[model samples]
Target: MSRTLVIGDIHGGLKALHQILERAEVTTNDKLVFLGDYIDGWSDSPRVIDFLIELDKTHDCFFIRGNHEEMVLRWLTAGDDNAEWRIHGGQSTVDAYQDLDIHTKDRHVGFLARLNDYYIDEQNRLYVHAGFTNQKGVYYEFFRGMFCWDRTLWETAMSLNPALSKDDLFYPKRLTLYKEIFIGHTPVTRISETVPVNKANVWNVDTGAAFKGRLSIMDVDTKAFWQSDPLHELYANEKGRN
Candidate 1:
């Protein structure tokens, strides 16, 4: 089987990301799937995006749109009018692009906007940036708020009701498709240690590398995971969040 490697939230930690990829021994034949949040939170947003773009040209790279990417896309499309983008770690992203030319800026914006919302393998492994709602048939609509921040839906589904039996767990009423959903948005302390909700269907790989956590990556088929130390301490100490 072709190796499918799923990378967690990068958040502009280029050094950490490079380390993890090196540790994972990623090759040309392996399929690399990035679980978004590629920009913001760190100091190398532009460099990270450029690296990914270049990697995409040579490797089988798949990227999903994370909440951070969505925020930037909103700013680029709407001209940062409401100032909502600034609140969600947008200032750093803006600063990253300040030195770039108009062509490069447009390229980055287009790249962010073109990211896929989700990817599902034939083996029933679902790859999404944040996650999908259990809201029946409309789950594929890519609802902005839900895609970027709907933890409640998944949480509610996992909570058992006394009225229903254990076997009668809440499943999406509209869709019968069941796959091991691999997601990254909410950061956990470990990469391999999954937040087991429904028989390990949902897995979170964001190890909070942009914050005080480590950068992580995992292989879907083998479940092999790798991580790198936090590289944001330098930025945090220097910028102090502006």
Candidate 2:
């Protein structure tokens, strides 16, 4: 079987991403899927996008839109008035694009604007930047609190109300059509291990790489995972500065 390699939040760490792909021995046959947050936090947003554009051209790569990408699209389209974009590591993103040409900037912005919110494989594996809420259909339209929000709602429902957990919140019977759900956005301390939220069906892979946490990758077929140590040195001084 071909491998579907899922990568976690990049947050502009192109070096770490390259290292992980090299370590994982990624091949052209494998379908590489990026969970989102490809740019922001780190110092190489422009380079990261450039690299992603190159990768997409050469490999079967799937891109999903994260909250960061949404903010970037908003900034590019509507201008940065809300100030919400800057709070979530937009300054670094801006810094990265400072030297880029106008045409290059426009191309990257257009790429972000065109990103899909989610991807569902034929095997029933749902890949989204953030996991879905109890809300049933039309999952992608409910973007306000979807892509970057925590899974606390589902966790609370699972713990406080077993009856509610037994409902569609924990394990959506309709989702039985898919094999698994893979997501990122909410940062975790470790990315190699899968956190089973709904009976081992849903997995969170953000791994908090942008915040000096691990950079993670998962194989879709064997479900094996690989991770690199926290790139703490890359962002040690930048922490809390933003």
Taking all chains together, each candidate's TM-score versus the true structure is: 0.83, 0.82
lDDT per residue (tens digit) for residues 10-44 in model 1:
87778888898899998889999998899877778
- Candidate 1 vs. true structure, TM-score: 0.83
- Residue-wise C-alpha lDDT for candidate 2, range 1-242, written one tens digit per residue: 46899998888777778878988888888899898888878887778888998998889999998888877777766776455566677888877777878899888888897787678888868888876554453253455456455465334323353344434656544344346777777665443433322334566777777776767888877767787656566556565113
Cα-lDDT of candidate 2: 0.71
Runs with alpha carbons beyond 4 Å of true place in candidate 1: 81-84, 135-145, 153-166, 169-176, 190-199, 233-242
The alpha-carbon lDDT assigned to residue 93 of candidate 1 equals: 82
Clashing pairs in 1: none
